[model samples]
Target: MSATGAIPVPPGKAGKAGKERFDAAGRRVLLVCVAGGFTTLIDQSVLNTSIPALRESLHAQPAHLQWIVAGYSLAFGLALIPGGRLGDVRGRKWFFVGGLALFTVVSLLSATATEPWALVVSRLLQGAGAGLVNSQMIGTLQDVFQGQLRARALGMYAVTGGLAFALGPPVGGAVLAAVGPEYGWRLTFLLNVPFGLATLWLAARHLPRPRPSARDADLDLVGLLLVGALTLALMLPFVQPPGWAGWLGFAVAAALLLGALAWWQRRFARAGGHPLIHPALTRSAPYALGTAVAMAQFGSSLAAGLVLAMFLQDGLGLSPLGAALVALPSAVAMGFASAVAWRVVARFGRRTVTAGMTGSALTMLTGGLVALWAPAGPLPWLLALLQLLGGASIGLMGASNQAFVLRHAPAEAAGVSGAILQMAQRIAAAVSISALSGVYLRATGGGGGHRAAFAWASGVCAAVAALAVLASVLAGRATAREEAAREESALAVTSNEPARESTRASG
Candidate 1:
């Protein structure tokens, strides 16, 4: 026995035991994280398919109808940073289970919603719960796995997310069709109940509880409040009726809220308590640039879907079922792409990012041109091609950017870093959808001019893709620097290690 009241074992045997324990823990953590991700998929996809049914049943107007979707998205985005911080401050297991419980309860409430407002509020709560669970997943993975294994786990995580996105719409539609509209939308939300309960039970029984590290800090409540206020202000314009006064008020609030939030974060950081986002992490070139790319890519993809769905239904006179079928190829492509993202990243590094973004930009530009010149001709094939191209691009850029961010983040700050990235993405999605919807509304003369609206929406996609290209360029440079630093560190460590002969002789 060692002096510290511990038993010392043979080095080989100890290493074997530790390895076995680590492998077991890693598998358990992966299972829990993947389960959480699956639920999030259900929540997101179910709502998307049920939007029309929700509108019909609740008698929701266009502006109000957007809330059915945007409400959940907004809440989910706003809560991400705080959720991550909570996981860091508390333990991951509690946050994970607590989030799942909140989600399950809210999902039930959503299923029971008879009024539009009831559904909206329930969706928001559901989003909040999802935010808590999702923001902790990457951090939990980092805590459980390391090196190549971590990369593989992340790849699998991406694959799971892709599968959820790909399957969500069709499944939601199938459930709705089977049960009838009265029960269809409700089932989408209610379906999450069993899955959530199962996750909670399995996690409690099998997941290893991680101890709070000494390095963990207290929650940054002030920073969190400020950021939350800023996000809410930004999303308010999208949800409210459009008027000059309303727009102006929201703009002013957003500016003030963001300014105050920035100042408070700086103040908090200087005061010794951790800020909601670690300044050092955000200040890193890779982190900052990677976040920008992530935001634009995800935001643009979501906006494209929203706008395209509208165009298909209104302009092409396609049914919701028909449009979803047309869109299936892209979604399927995205799923396949996610599965292979690890191989792509390992082979091409950041070049994969640049290429993907460039491809997306070209695809959007081409789609817009084609739609404008030939709106009625070859509609299905044109859309099919566009979706395939877009899906491939999203798969490459989305997973690659995530890997890039994780590679650069310090292990301890993974939670907060992921939170910030997700925050940017949410804000971007909210703002883009609002702005694009406005553009489509104006172009179509308030929903009557479908052709013009589709053209305008295509234009927005092009602009977003262009912005992504710029982000890709910056990401490329940052990746180069990171690779150089890694090489230098490796060399330094190798130089400092004792000679092999000397080590062997001493042993």
Candidate 2:
């Protein structure tokens, strides 16, 4: 109905105006989400290079140091699924705010802690908070964006995460250099405080209110418990690698827990409840293949990063700061590549993923050859150049792979799907980094030289990357086959329609 003497706007123009307004709002929201993601991810690795400083400052034992690293990750992996479900059921706005507030408070506590136990506990609580906020961030992106915009938004998200990981070491090293060891480590925790508070404010102002769930919504507690336990079982050995005997025990426990989880999910769904992970998601070919690709690439790529840092410091005798600087190109290139990755995805579909994985594999293999034979004077420069390409390759693979996998998630279960995909990547990084470290250490200890160790580790990463390439290829072929089948069915229906109409007319 129009007001008297006023004309009604054309429907198409009105719709375009509405869509433009919505998109502007979504972009503002995305900035807040990406900031939250960047904060937590940077914290994940920022402490690694500062471990020595922490040990000296806190008077910590080796065991305490180990816990300081392992505990945070343990809590993070445990919290993801449950946290995601909470956001799904409850509103994301309050949950995201509460989580960020918790993270901020805990960061302050960590900075002030005088005892090792206090710091350890603070880290655990902080990880839980981060896990909670991160789930909502991923969930919000899933809710707010669609089509190519969704892919591009997720690409930016990936860029931040990758950049955070790569930059953490350098960031920490710089802080330590700026301040003496006595205070350097404390400042790292303190750094999160200001950024967290700012992001929390933006989130409170800009994030959307969550839609209410049904009054009878079920959380599937049993499924949540199973998931948490299974995650611990699968992750513990990798984070703190054990003897072969202990490894066997954890592996067996993980397998049994997994079976139990699958059974429970199905039974719960049959009984008219929502499973934490939908059965259809587990059965989805695209999801399965995409996950495999993510795990392989994420684990191996991170392993290569860790190994490269070591090679620079140990193999090349560069200082920590120097090593970090040499590796900076890779991180910078990753962000650059991620910024434009969606354009390639628009053109190539899954082939973009395949191309990226192929590039990564080549980069790793080339790194190995260069490490073994490059002149000492030029080695660092040459390796840094290669790493630049490596980072871009990863950016392309990660952004495309994440968008593809998450799109397959049912709208109702988007949070769970994103959590699961991230979970796989985290677990894979733990295992692969541990395994690759052993390879490097073994070679170095046996007098095989750091050059050989770098070569060996790079070879392993390249092999895993090749596996990712294979998985991406298979996934793309499956999609093509499904599209062809759908087209054939549609054409058949159209061709038969005219004949059926004539017969009806004659009758």
Q: Identify the runs in model 1 with alpha carbons over 4 angstroms from their true place.
A: 1-25, 179-182, 210-217, 241-249, 375-377, 410-412, 438-447, 481-507
**Residue-wise C-alpha lDDT for candidate 2, range 268-341, written one tens digit per residue:** 99998878778777776667788899989988976787677667866887765666677788778888877787
Clashing pairs in 1: none
TM-score of each: 0.85, 0.85
lDDT of 1 by residue, 1-507 (tens): 221111345867856654643367678778888998888755775566666667678887666656666666677777777777666666788888888899999988988888888877887788888888887786777667876677768767766766676667667666766787677878888899999999988778766575776665567778777776776676666656559988898889889988887788888888887787787776677778778888887777666777676677556766556667767777788877776765676566677777888887787777767777774758767887888887787787677778777667765666567677777777677666666655664566454567667776877777887888887787677666666777789888888676865788899
Query: lDDT, candidate 2, residue 65?
Result: 57
Best by lDDT: 2
